[model samples]
Target: YVENNLAQKTIELFNELKNPADVNKTLLNQMKLDDIQSSIPIYLSAIKAVSQIGDYSKAQSIFKQIPDSLLVENQIRSALIDLWGKVGSVVEAKLIFDKIRQPNIIEYTTMGLF
Candidate 1:
């Protein structure tokens, strides 16, 4: 029952990905209540969808709402940086890079590509 509920929530949020601003964050508030990003796939999917449509600012806003502890992950940070760079937000990219706790080679390499 627990697994089914999570899967259902993910599906509901996936539909909302079409327009992130329209996303009812309340659905994902469980993560905020837990003081975590809660769902990596949701965050990544939102970032990817927003970036594809050239909405970096919206993506950044979503990324910012996620807790810093969860943001420490290289994949999440790198993906955000890539979105920033893609939309010519180099400063945003730099800010994210500086925020990394201890960026590894993959993070360095990913940022370099941006």
Candidate 2:
């Protein structure tokens, strides 16, 4: 279901479900594998959360888990670039920025913000 793999939806469900965090984490990961396309943002959010929690390695793994196709999308690429930048992932962020072709103003701004 779209509800399961969407980042906002996954986050929303996690907030609503008062079960153990492990349960939510497992469910989210399952949803991600089940729908990699829809799960791109979910993976990004996971990366952001892990990074914020001081788990840069985990965040990198989550970011790496994103499908290549999804990572090329404008919005998703921008988000990943911004995320890498904010987390001080210079190499990852630069690589992502370099891969963008014909980037628009938003993407330019996002890369610049790093």
TM-score for all models, in order of appearance: 0.65, 0.64
Candidate 1 residue lDDT tens string, 1-95:
13434667557665766555436344445546644445666677657766766776676567666667668777788888887877778888889
**Model 2 Cα RMSD, Å?**
5.2
lDDT of 1 at 107: 73
Candidate 1 lDDT at 27 equals 42
lDDT of 2 by residue, 56-95 (tens): 5655756656677787787777777777777778688788
Clashing pairs in 2: none
Local lDDT at 66 for model 2: 69
Error of 1 at 82 (Å): 0.9
- Whole-model alpha-carbon lDDT for candidate 2: 0.65
Q: Count the backbone clashes (under 3 Å) in each candidate.
A: 0, 0
| Alpha carbon lDDT at 16, candidate 2 | 65
Residue 50 displacement (Å), model 2 = 4.3
